[model samples]
Target: MTDLLEQAVLTARNLPAERQDDLARMMLSYAGYDEPVIDLTPEEEADLIEAQAEMERGEFATDAEVEAVLSKFRP
Candidate 1:
């Protein structure tokens, strides 16, 4: 393995089981494996459904609203 990947594996080894599993999924996907990487919780699924409903109803932020949020990060 590459030096960086060896180091990353060491770091990941120290993470919690859930976090390690998440990293493993990402690495497998990057290695060209076709598999589902994410398993969403019930609350997350509900949030996605609500977001879809909002989108279907044409509810969206205005351009000025977007700029207002972005301008906070400008130098």
Candidate 2:
């Protein structure tokens, strides 16, 4: 790997495992790998399907729900 990419991977090592997996997934997808970076559990798979259906049905979190979530990380 190039020095810049090596530095990025090293920096990502300090992140939480889930964030690291997300970065790895993006990298692999960009590299055109036709495979999953990680296997989702049955529940996760079902959740994704349900989320897609909700999106197709024009269902989304209300603004209050979004603000409530954002508030958790706000000072």
Candidate 3:
């Protein structure tokens, strides 16, 4: 490992367990590791199904609409 990475690991080793876990997750993400599977709740699953049905019916936002909605969040 590079000196900087070695130093980071050594520093992480001295951190609390939760901080170590957070650092490990950040490192995995930085290394392009796939995230852990997330099981959707029943309500979320229902929402996804409804969204799929809407998509099948061609009921979706247009690009302009999406851009307009996204622009609302920009500073």
Top model number, TM-score: 2
User: What TM value does model 1 have?
Assistant: 0.48
Error of 2 at 71 (Å): 0.8
Candidate 2 similarity to native, TM-score: 0.49
In model 1, what lDDT does residue 51 have?
Answer: 98
Stretches of candidate 1 off by over 4 Å are 1-36
Q: How does each model score on lDDT?
A: 0.93, 0.93, 0.93
Writing each residue's lDDT as its tens digit, candidate 2 over 1-75 gives 999999999999999999999999889897769664677899999999999999999999999999999999999
RMSD of 2: 12.9
Give the clashing pairs for model 2.
none
Instruction: Name the lDDT of candidate 1.
Output: 0.93
lDDT of 1 at 62: 98
- By TM-score, the better pick of 1 and 2 is 2
Candidate 1 on 1-75: residue-level lDDT in tens? 999999999999999999999999888887658865577899999999999999999999999999999999999
User: Candidate 3's residue-wise lDDT over 1-75, tens digit each?
Assistant: 999999999999999999999999888987768775567999999999999999999998999999999999999
Clashing pairs in 1: none
